[model samples]
Target: MNKSNNKLNKIIDYIRKDNGINNAIEATEQASLLLILKYFYDNSFSNTIDKLPPFSKVFLKGYKSHQSRNGTGYLTLNNIFDERIKSNSSFRSFKKLEEFLALVPFRVHSIKIVEVILHILDEIQVDESLADDYDNLIVSMTNSSISSGAFHTPIALVSALVKVSKPNKMQRIYDPAMGTGRFFVESQKLVKDDFLHFRGNDLSAFACLIGSVNLLLNGICIDNINIEDSFLYEDNKKYDLIYSGVPFGKPSDISKYGHEYHDYKNSLEGMFLKHTMDKLALEGKAVLIVPDGLLSNMTNGFKDLRYQLLTHFNLHSILSLPSGILLPYTSVKVSVLFFDNSPPDEDVWYYDLALNKNINKRTPIKEDDFSEFISLFEKREVSERSYLVNKKSILNDRLFNLSIPLPTNEETIKFDKAQEIAQLNSENLKLFSSITNYFDVTSRDIKVENTDIRTIKSLGNLKTGNNLTKSELLGNGSFPVYGGNGIIGYYDKANRDENTIIIGKVGLYCGNIHFSEEPFWLTNNAISLEIQDTSRVFAPYLAHLLRGLDLNKLSTGAVQKFVSIKKLNDIEVSLPSYEKQVELSNYFNELEQAKSSLDKLLSSFNEGISLLNKNIILEKVIN
Candidate 1:
């Protein structure tokens, strides 16, 4: 076992050192192909030799001859490589290899590299356990680059989904967006049935190639893998089980699907959901990892989709995963939805797998972490982490929001608190205008007096904050980390100490203004303001002024709106005198103090009301 692990590590080290591979995705793909070839070559000598392609022997023979002469022999392996791949084109699983090879950069040292890798593979004994070693190799390579590894699902997540769904013998399984075939490989470990058939598809030909190789490494030869966008294409065959981690946030051009999907023409999640529903067999179950927005979004499209899910399918359970589950790639919170084609259930089970520990690349989710969840899942018992919500409540009260509902006691407290806060905020806004009336009047007077207009550059220096990865942010850190919006998470250290004005520098929240009084860490997603002349411009006052200007209009980028520091610096503002500015700042401070007092009063009021209500109930019961 140690020797096999060492060989796998050696292969990963070799690929990482190769200059030809630009990223982890490329390195992993190359390693997968080499490993698959070795697996098949070794199997060619066994009783299952007939399943191997005829060209397999020829390919290995030519590779060995070329290696013997140190890659300088006149063996002409390029033609052999092309011929072998072409010969396998008739096979569904291997046809995508041609496209995958075209994308891979086979450099001058490629043959020598392959030879070294093949020699190591030959040393390791080929067995069913070897597939796991190959999976570990892929995981190691993919972790080197986050963006490149975004498609690969973490094994722990896959195992949890598999265990929850519970694959059985003689079942047909399918994954529409099967990246590297992790779901299939994990499922195979439990079922171990010859009748268990696997089918999958992916948009990227490279992904299809790697997925095919992954399945083959595990002694599972699937013939129905395809390289096509699952959203646009329609598969007629129904499956017993479907599992997928569909793409989120990317709007698809679903015009080709016709007018029935007019509302969901741009929503990729909606399309995938509709497609999955259509493809399920009479009792087929689907386990999907979807973004949290799909559950609570008020869009007409999302509401309609959720309504269909509740009414048509037997929605089983929802597992809310942690936020940083897909860290470094994206911090979007996701949940698993389990449903089947049977009669609809009146209530749906929900398990909140809220982990206290931070989940990142270094510390990932594990199957064992879900031990309590798995034990309670079958009975659908109510506990601190799990609950049940009726379908009527979801449709009538929530407007089809499927997000896990907060506990009754907690929900009432939060709703009361939020109502109080909203009222206070509305009153505060009114008071803000009255206090800052001097500035508004001064600006109007300046227009008549023809006073000099001051640019932000003259008042302060604007610079983007430093970049910090999601992994760097801690769950229980000392300081908040501000992103494009407000504080995204907490960090261990602070980059800015004083009260500073920040503007969202990119994406959806571009040009949104925020004022941070406490020390905080700032990311490049926002631009911070350092007042050069504090006497003339108070930070809070400047933030309020910029908010009125509608700075989002200055944002650039057709797809992802962003505002550069130069654009912010060029924004013109009508500044009042220093004394007037200080007076306005003082008023703003007093308004904040008033709001703080209101919060304290509301807290006391809530406690008193709770005690009074309890006493009333107890008195009525005694009487």
Candidate 2:
């Protein structure tokens, strides 16, 4: 963490220590806002705290009264607070200033929060983006609602999206899901023209307040920062450049959108996609982060929405972000969809930024990580990480799944090397065929053998695993601890030692498959598998076979999806003889090895192709 981050965390910690504040989130938010307001006023009137906003003036009066040894100090503070709530709506939320008093405990400690604010203020200097200084605090501390689907957009991502859109002073901008207005502030910093106008809307009241303060302190007006459900709000306003990180997997309330919500409004992100398309001016451009499921979901509404996007807009680019970018919030993979309200294009570009970085809340992402992507993106050039696909190919795919496919291992092999290998293999095949032909090759007639079909329960035992809470995860234990989404952490002890298949039994990753060859601890969220007759069926082969089954489709659970053992047992599978199972397992293992080697080769080819492209571009440079 940097210096500013530590200071903000210190303030949050101090405010959270107050027992009087029943809602710690609300209290921290209010205090953070108040401290920021004071800093804003102090910057304007450095000599004294007077002439500040009416709200600040009232708070200062209470603080001053407590300092003096004259009257009932605490009572005097309550009187000022009561007066402010009656007069100001912003103060209404923080009705009991006593809670704040509790946070400060000692009247002398009043300056502690103020000092932190000032330190933050100093960092938000000429060149610093507001997000660069305060985004971490705003995101980490703000409350998250699953229904709202809103999460803090990383500052690095916000900045990159803003740059990608290339916001100008003359153009209008908007962020429908603008939490804390990070996008708005970043846009303001990039504006080179004289006139700049942007609109922001969010359903969360706390977000609106925090956003208002963030914009105000950044020297931007907050007149258009509306605190309303953007989906319900009616407006015909169009923008030249727009960007947003829409809530992922949230339900849409179509009741508010009226007839406009008739089609795909059943889907939350689909509704956001439609809304953005409708709000964009002719030839206008937009970049939004959407859940990857939206691209692949087979829902009628989602499919229609995908078609609508490709037909009505120039679906120019899709940037696939790897898992963990939104960690501590969601593990769902997301993509940045860049499109314009122009005629549909013949080809769309895609970039894969899934380059092996394990991003989490503790280990944050930096702008430099996106430098190569941004550089390649700005030039609209194809690299190992980027490619262009034909629109017709997308139209042919099921549900028009716009999810860009990264280069396969085979595709990554250079054309020359691949061709040479292909020729060699072709020659070898012909020679072998000639030898067999010369030897009078023949096929022996054999009867087809039938294998018995059996349910999972008939062949094995399935039971829920042990519970390994996030708090108990030591991370440095001797054995890997498996969860719904695979190894979450490590533990000191192993629960099971036999080779088995772990099936995600609960949550978003329900039905997901993970194979463990060594002893490991499995979370209760998943089901541990132990084949009763391993000689008849290889464990690895069964694991691979189970993986082919669409388990996610059978998942149950309203709030949290789950796949139960009963459901697994109901699905019948073919069981082969012991000798056949062994032979098949060996064959599968060889195929896996081949696939792994191909992946490595493809990865290398991708790197080589990218290098070649970059060199070609450099050679064309005038300098």
Candidate 3:
């Protein structure tokens, strides 16, 4: 391994300390940078940092302080984070942290603090022997530009995508805002020294170092990786399999770009797309991780990017990722844009990875709670694939990309001329999806001869659950309550008995799922899906069946998250008579017992893999 890579990893270890920093993004960035400086000093590339300039020393100190404040001092200029939250109520959609985001604009809007820190590092004194420690330090710190320690698209998600949506192989891949080199790392072919091909860029020099190191560690060549602010037209590189998880929001006007683009606060993602196309080799492919707001931003900026993408690339697919992918900090819904440099294809394969559960936004891979989504998306059945009414297919009329028409019918419609004859169809999708997809079925599917749903609805006005002290703990309930991620002890008070069938009032856990009925309490975080109908509704049996169904898509919340009780009733449970409900519930009770036994067997299987230490691979990967 190169001295630089070694140095960076050491610094990252010291700063991150594994258990120390929860955010993965910081660990990668800080580790790489400190290593570079140490490598330069230790390898005799440069003498003491003090041998040169004075300002550089101050930059190092200031950067250290900033990162320590939040351990993101090196590159993230978070001065304006607190201020951005206070901009106004228009941006004040979140009730819990209204003031925090409002202040982002005021505190550290520009990267000046980071720039100064960089300047200082450029001129500071250095110690050669401490290279390893320094490298570890750099990697552990969080970054301001991108949320440090993000839940990147899982490797399984990518591999499944490759299998289902087979793209042309032998094409070069690229990540424009490659933070810690996630997408690239997953693409590297096993048993091979290099990726079939790859390239990437990042704003932070620290991030670049980490990304570069990550690439090298994966056995990919270092020369292919470029560390620079890709948005500034930095690396004149190109590729085919371009995969990126770029940051969102409007573009900034840096003096480096000159004044013509001064008022550029549009989709930074859109700008990345333009850049991706700019450097893309002939017939290159790109899969961009973008925000959902961009899909319907309606701004000319969005329209322009969408139109340009349609013309230059074959818009292959749009996979709308589940919400809460990056939660506890951010709740922005993200989508994947998969396209190729070639002309338009016959049809765009749009899939929705229906991940709607909230995740505890802690670090050290805190996302493990929802991590099961990887397997689910991978298991999503292929074929039975319809553009409209398919059950397994996440993208039916519910998703908007279905707007594009198949040209097969164009000759039949020579006189109709659909493109010019009709208007854009975004509004139609939202309206139809709201009324039909979420509702109608789940609500009206119930057919009662004697008892009405009112019996279940009258469980003495649902009481709220506990008010958690730690906001991060909000998603991590010990045992789930009525909702998707709440626990039993996390309750305020229970007006009803223990056997009450609690329902998820908000999110997808609404219609189905019952809680532990042994004198347990539900959290205010979840609406108790109670049923007063003791005569008809077999709560446990119903909960089991309903739990199988996803109810999050029908949820409705404005600022504070919530689901409608009226809409939740539409779900029709396959209640097999009162005898069957009891028999099935009894059968399920036994099944649960059997599952525990099977779970133990599965647990034993994992024991071997768990015993195999990750550090063992270090020797093979490094040299």
Best by TM-score: 1
Question: Per-residue lDDT tens digits of candidate 3, residues 265-366?
Answer: 555666676677777777776777777766644446555566656556676666666676554335787777767778775444545554334433332223
**Would you list the clashing residue pairs of candidate 2?**
149-247
Give the residue spans of candidate 3 off by over 4 A.
1-146, 150-170, 194-197, 234-237, 254-264, 355-623
lDDT of predicted model 1: 0.71
lDDT of 2: 0.66
Q: How accurate locally, in lDDT, is each candidate? A: 0.71, 0.66, 0.47
Model 2: runs farther than 4 Å from truth?
Answer: 1-7, 20-24, 39-57, 60-133, 139-149, 192-195, 409-623
lDDT for model 3 = 0.47
Over all chains combined, what TM-score does candidate 3 have?
Answer: 0.42
On TM-score, who's better, 2 or 3?
2
Instruction: Assess every candidate by TM-score.
Output: 0.63, 0.57, 0.42
Write one digit per residue (lDDT tens) for candidate 2, span 18-70.
Answer: 44332334444555455544443334333544454444445556655655644
Indicate whether candidate 1 or candidate 3 has the larger TM-score. Answer: 1
**Root-mean-square deviation of each candidate, in angstroms?**
10.5, 13.4, 19.5
